[model samples]
Target: MKWSEISIHTTNEAVEPISNILHEAGASGVVIEDPEELSKEREQVFGEIYQLNPDDYPEEGVIVKAYLPVTSFLGETVDEIKEAINSLVTFNIDIGHNKVTISEVNEEEWATAWKKYYHPVKISEKFTIVPTWETYEKVSSDELIIELDPGMAFGTGTHPTTVMCIQALERTVKAGESVIDVGTGSGVLSIAAALLGAKDVRAFDLDEVAVNSAKLNIELNKVHDVVEVSQNNLLNDVKGTVDVIVANILSEIILLFVEDAFNLVKPGGYFITSGIIQPKKQEVKSALLEAGFEIFETLTMEDWVSFIAKRP
Candidate 1:
């Protein structure tokens, strides 16, 4: 089947809104790309890797690419899709034929695609993250199982940073303690905390999509009563101090919000941080010290580090 690849370029600030407009205009799926996320070198590398036939990569603020089968009729005309996209910002639109052929993908094949990348990930001696699509018959019944099928969401416990955070959670969070997970991608840590005997757990993310995804994951784990997933920035909207806090965000954002994180934790509460690149460990440690936190322990995995610190 022939497919039309509609490419639209606009500023990063306008990409999401424009993508929404195009979707409303009858595009099945919109691929949003942030220009800042891709450099010239990256684009060239991507083109070479995909062996793109058209061999064109846009260099602009932000780009939204959509593919629709020619036979599939859009509720709106091509001109209407173009005009709606243009209204979002100053953009350039290009239409091309997709050299890539389409094929039918069944549920079993789609499930295998994700399962291939996931394995029986052992977070600690007592905890293991098992993808729902795969069996964990080798795992002992005494171990805690976190059944997850993270589809397009952040947390799968496979990422080094996520594993580091999970390890930290296992070691630090105690029974009956209140926990708050900031930027709780996939709610893995939060759900794990609940499973580990956290009395009260609340998770929040800046992305609504992530929040919704986390809600689904929370339900999947059957921890809805203990873990509450919501949309919030850090702990700005949360009230009172939590016994423990977990944050798995970039080092820069972690440093920026260190003080706020400190304020959200109880005086003797612990704060666990991950997503620190190897080169930025000292910088993050310095920020933690400056925030009046005493570093307790640090775990490093594949150049990523997770730090456990206590607010004094």
Candidate 2:
């Protein structure tokens, strides 16, 4: 079978939203080729470091690749994807070059080729994200390993936005506490909260695909017992307050539910928000404050920003 590869040359800031656009367009998965991967510093304490090929990456910005089966409506799907990505500019997100191109390839080539890009990486002090395909051995007694496949939806949980949220979970999630992970994606954050000893974890995503993908990863991590996966629009049907509420979605979406988050967090509990670009950090912070959350800690990686706000 043949598949069309849609490649977009864009900035790192746009990777999350663009990948989401492609996923919504029926792409099963995405391949990110960022030049920074060639020079990234990895801590060898968790496990082996997989070597990256420089040729696969763009010299500037990032390349997001997704495969769509060859079909008669392929052209229209591609056009819609391009439009969706371009629309991100209205949210104050920089789209960079935004050069999009398409090429045809054999299914055999991409079916398992994208797996090579994922490996065990220690994203935070206590959490290391290991792909389900890889075998890893923990080097410390207190290390937490999260196994994920990211099958057909979400990411490998190594994106800076995700890493920051996991780190925040480590700092805030206490044993027996309850957690609500908004826009759970592949359910990585919910799993982390469970592993960190949260007794009850709830994961919600509007996309049914993401809900299923997260359910698989949650079970893979053996946290299904503690985490409940469901399909819901951000806090719309949510009831009861949780000890910690973490969201790693676009900042614009985060802004929409600030008051909901505030109302759903127990006193002195935390609200962790990521997937925020530098330009919109102040805007989100302002919203959180307006919702009555006290700014706790702000985490920054590359050009992304994450905020840990506490309800006083």
Candidate 3:
């Protein structure tokens, strides 16, 4: 079968939204080619392979590639994808050179090609994300491993936003406590919560693809017995209170549910928010403060930010 590979040249700040745009436009999965990943430092103890070839990445901006079946409306679909990506400017996301290129390829080529980019990454001190196809040994007695096949729903648990969320969970999740993971793409965060000793972990995502991917990953990591994955828009229909609520979504979306998150968290519970660009840190911080959450810690990685706030 023939596939139309759509490649977009954009910046790191716009990778998440652009990837989502491609997925919404019928992309089965995406390949993110960022030059930074080529030079990223890895812990040798994890036995991570770093034999990266330079030709796969762009020199300046990041390249996001997605495959779609070459249907009759292929041109129209590509145009719509471009339009949707352009819409991110309204969110103040830097799109860089939004040049898009298309090519013809076959499924077998992409099937193994994309898998080479993912490896076992120690995202936090306690949590290490291992691709289901790779084998990793636990480096420490207390180290926790999460095996995942992210598929096309994103959330590999290696992105800075996700890394920060899991790190916060490591510090905050208590034994037998409950956790709510909003926008639980691939169920990575929810699974991490369960592994951290949370007895009850409820994960929600508006995208059905994400819900399904999360379920697969949850079971793959053997956390399905503890974490429950479902499809829902934000915090709607959520009842009772949890000890911790974690969300690694865009800051603009985080603003939408800060109040709802506060109400859903019990007193002394925590709200951990990431997927925030550095520029929007103040805006998210203000929203949490206005919602009566006492700011506990602010975590920053690269140009991204994550906040941990306690309900007093």
Candidate achieving the largest TM-score: 2
> Candidate 2's residue-wise lDDT over 146-233, tens digit each?
9987554758788889988998998899999999999998889999999999999999999998888888888788888999999999
lDDT of 1 by residue, 121-234 (tens): 666767778777776764566678778765535336655677778778888889999999988867888988998899999998887777877887888889999998888877
Residue-level error in angstroms, candidate 2, position 2: 1.9
Candidate 3 overall Cα lDDT vs. reference? 0.87
Question: RMSD in Å for candidate 3, one decimal?
Answer: 1.8
- Residue 82, candidate 1: how far off, in angstroms? 20
List, residue by residue over 1-312, the lDDT tens digit for candidate 3: 778889999999998888778777877667889898778776664435678889989999899988888999999999999999899999999999999999988889856767878888887878888888887888889999988875646646677888889989988999999999998877888989999899999999898877887888887888889998888999997899999999988889999999999999999999999999989999999999999999999998878999999999
Clash count, candidate 3: 0
Identify the candidate with maximal lDDT: 2
Residue pairs clashing, model 1: none
Residue 249 in model 3: shift from native, Å? Answer: 0.7
All candidates in order of TM-score, best leading: 2, 3, 1
Which ten-residue region of model 3 has the weakest summed lDDT?
40-49
Compute the lDDT of residue 231 as modeled in candidate 3.
88
Candidate RMSDs in Å, in order, are 9.7, 1.6, 1.8
lDDT, residue 25, candidate 3? 80
